[model samples]
Target: MLTLTHRDMLTLKHRDMLAFGHRDMLAFGHMAMLTLTHRDMLTLTQRDMLAFGHMAMLTLRHLDMLTLTHRDMLAFGHMDMLTRTGTC
Candidate 1:
């Protein structure tokens, strides 16, 4: 049996978010809405974690679309991970 850490799970979630392109935000939004609407099926903590991950992904995507500085992106990326893991 293999066990995954929370960091590993979050990494996979981030990878899924990165799999989409800028042109796919509309589709992503629709999918996210569907997922979020059914979030009642998840535990409160799970829902909160998912919401945080989605927000991080959206913010990163928005900044990318704006052609933000590499340093800014790096900072956001670091902050997102730390924030999500409650280490910030």
Candidate 2:
């Protein structure tokens, strides 16, 4: 519900910037406000990373990979035991 003017923001150190949404200042019109300074690219990269992370989570949820991996590990252990005893 409040805002910080450019002067107020400029007074903040890099470490202190986080409290003020400084990461979103990539397009502040003033040349000095840019960090990596590629505004569009930074925005796009953030969006893509979020999308990929969500997709990965959905895939993991659907595949139940942890249970499958545990089953495979148990199978491998049984095979190892059988091989040790020459049972198969």
TM, every model: 0.15, 0.14
Clashes in predicted model 2: 0
lDDT by residue (1-88, candidate 2, tens digit) is: 1233343222322222222122222222111222221111222111111111111111112212211111111111211221111211
Colliding pairs, model 2 = none
Q: Provide the lowest-lDDT 10-residue window in model 2.
A: 46-55
For model 2, the stretches where C-alpha displacement exceeds 4 angstroms are 1-9, 18-25, 30-45, 48-88
Q: Give candidate 1's error at residue 63 in angstroms.
A: 14
C-alpha lDDT values of all predictions? 0.24, 0.19
lDDT of 1 by residue, 4-88 (tens): 2233232222222222222222212111221222112221211122222232333322212222211121112311442333321
- Estimate candidate 2's alpha-carbon lDDT, on a 0 to 1 scale: 0.19
